[model samples]
Target: MRILITAGGTSEKIDDVRAITNHSSGKLGKAIAEAFSAEGATIDYITTKQALHPDNDEATIHLIESTADLAAKLNELMTAHRYTAVIHSMAVSDFTPESSVTIEDLQDTIAAKPDDLALALKEKVRERTEKKISSDTDHLVIVLKKNPKVIQQIKQLQPETILVGFKLLVDVPMIQLLDVAKASMEKNDADFILANDLAEISGEKHHGYLINRHHKVKEAQTKSEIAQLIKQEVLKLEEAK
Candidate 1:
C-alpha cells in the first residue's frame, strides 16, 4: 500500500529571525515510516528542516516550514498521487501572528479614548510587521488569529484514503483525552486516531491509544510499538478489502 506521513512541528515566522514553533522531535513519524517501509509500502514523507527523518532511500521526502506551505504542498501531492493511507503526525500551530504593536502605543490609544475602549484601538493603533522587530520597545503586543484545522482538509482531498490522526494532550486524564480524540477524529472524518499524553511520553515510556471509527481501541507503549500497531491495522484493512 502507498502511504503519506507528515512529521515534526511547523514553524510560523514572527520576523526574519524569530518564529513560533513546538518541541516535536518527529521520532514517531520516522519510526512509522520505517515500519511501513519494512512492509514494502511506498512512503511520502512531508516534514520540516530540523526534525528527524527515516534514512530509507526509497521513501520520497517533502520539506515545509509554515502551515500555509504545508497546505499548499499537501494540495499538490494529494492531487498528483493516489495514496492508500495518510498518517498526520505533524504538530501544527493553532494561531498565527496577525499584527504586532508596541505596548506604549497601545497604552497611549487607551489613554486618549478612555470612554470607548474598542474605538480607541480601532482608530489609533497602527499595526506593523518589520523584517526584524526593533528592540527599542520595552514591551510589545502581538495579535494572533486562529488557523484552519489542516487535518480536516485531508479527508476532503482524498475521501477513500485511510486517514490516521494523532492527538497529543498534556497532563490530561485518560477519559478526557480519549473523548477529545474521538471528537477530533469524527470532526476530521479520520478512520483512526492515536491519542497520547505528553506527560506520559519519555523515550521508550511513551504510551498511546489507537482508536478507530467503531471505537475499537488498541494500546501501545512506545513509538516503535505504535508504528507496529498502525501497520498491523492498515494491513488488516487492506487485506479485508
Candidate 2:
C-alpha cells in the first residue's frame, strides 16, 4: 500500500524574524509513518521539521515550511503518484498571516526623525527606543487566513482513496464528540475519522475512536496502535476495490 502522511505544525510568520507556531512535537505522525513502513507500505511524509523516513531510499520525504507550501506539495505528489491512502496527521495551523514586516522597516521609520544629538544621548535614545520598540512588537498584528482543508482536497483529487482525518476534542460530551466527528468526516469526505481526547492523549499514551464510513466506531489506544487500525481498514478497502 502507498500511504501519504503529514506531520508537524506550520509556523506562521509574524515578522521577518518572528513567527506564530504551536507546540506540536510531531511524535504521533512519526510513529504512524514508522509503523506503516514496518508493514512494508511505501510512505510519503510531508512535514515542517527536518524529517527522516523509515527507509530513506524506499520512502519519499518532503520538508515543508508553511501550510501553503504543504498544500502545494501534497497536490503535486498526489497528482504524480497513485496513493492507496492519505492520512491527515499533521497539527496544521488553521490561521496564518498574509504577509510579514521587518524590524529594519520599523527602525527606519523611528530613526527618520530630524534630530541630531551627542553620541552619549544617541546611544541612550537608541537603546531606550529599541527597548520600547521591542516591547511594542506584540502590537504588530497580522490578519490570518485559514488554511485549505487538506482532507477535502485529497478526497476531491482521488474519490476512491481511503482518507483518514484526526480530530482532537476537549471536554466535549460523547454525543457531541460523535456529532463533530461525523460532521468532520462528511465535510472532509474521509473514510475514517480518528477522534481523540486531546487532554488524555499526550506523549506516549492515547485513547480515541475510529469512526468509519458506515459510522461504525472502534476504540484506539496509542499512536502506533491507531496506525495499525488505520492500516487494516485501508487494506480492507483496497481489497474491496
Candidate 3:
C-alpha cells in the first residue's frame, strides 16, 4: 500500500523575519505516518517542524513550511503518484499573510540605511501595499488565498482513495462530535473522520474517536492505538475492493 499524510501547522510569514503559525504538535499526523510505515506500506509525509516523527528508511518525508507550499506540494504529489490512501491530519493554518517577505529583496534598502533592518523591511512592505492600492488592481489586494483543503481535493483527484480527515473539538458533546464529523466528511469528501475532544483527550495520555461513513464511532485512547484502528479500517476497505 502507498499512503500520503500531511502533518503540522503552516507558518505564514509576517515580515522578512517574522511569521504567524499555530500550536499544532503534529503528534497525530506523525503517528499515522509511523504506523503506516510499520505496516510495510510506502509512506510519504508533509509536515512542519512542530512535530518530528522518527525517520524510517521505508518512508519519505517532505518539509512544508507554509500553507501555499502545502497546497502546491500536495497537488504535485497527488498528480504524480498513485496512492491507496491520503490522510489529512495537518492542522493547516487557516490563514496566512497575504504578503510574504524576502530578506534578499530588503538587503539593498537595509544596506543604504544605518537603521535596523526591521524598519527598512516595514517600509518596504508598506511601499508594496501602497503600490498595490494605487494600481487599483483587485489581484494585488492583500488578502489570503484559501489553501486547498487537502481531503476534498485528494478525493477529487482519486475518489476511490481512502481519504480520512481529522476533526478536533473541545468540551463539546458526543452528539456534536458526530454532527461535526458528518459535516466534515461531506465537506471534505472523506471516507471517515477522526473526531475527538482535544480538550478532553489531548495532554491527558488518553483516547480519540473514529467516525466512519456509517456514522459509527469507536474510541482509542493512545495515538498508537488510534493508528491501529485506522490501519484496520483502511485494510478492510482494501479487502472490500
TM-score of each: 0.91, 0.79, 0.78
CA lDDT of 26 in candidate 2?
Answer: 75
Q: Whose TM-score is higher: candidate 2's or candidate 3's?
A: 2
lDDT for 97 (candidate 2): 60
* TM-score pick, better of 1 and 2: 1
Cα error, candidate 1, residue 143 (Å): 1.4
lDDT (10s digit) by residue, model 1, range 139-205 = 9876667888888889899988899999999999999999999998889999899999999999867
Show where candidate 2 strays beyond 4 Å.
50-58, 99-134, 137-140
User: Among all windows of ten consecutive residues in candidate 3, which has the lowest summed lDDT?
Assistant: 132-141
Ranking by TM-score: 1, 2, 3
Clash total of candidate 3:
2
**Root-mean-square deviation (CA) per prediction:** 2.7, 8.4, 9.2
Which RMSD does model 3 reach against the true structure? 9.2
Model 2 shows how many backbone clashes?
0
Q: What overall lDDT, based on C-alpha atoms, would model 2 receive against the true structure? A: 0.74
Please provide, for model 2 over 1-241, each residue's C-alpha lDDT reduced to its tens digit, 9 standing for 90 to 100: 7889987776776555767785467777777787778878888988876433344654577888777787899899889888888988777778876532234443554476536423323343344433222443444424456777666789888887888898878888777888899999989889889888777677678888889989999887887788778778878878998
In Å, residue 225's CA in model 1 sits off its true spot by: 0.3
Tell me the tens digit of each residue's lDDT in model 3 across 120-220.
55556666643322333333323344555655578878877998888887789888888988999888888879887877665526467888888888888
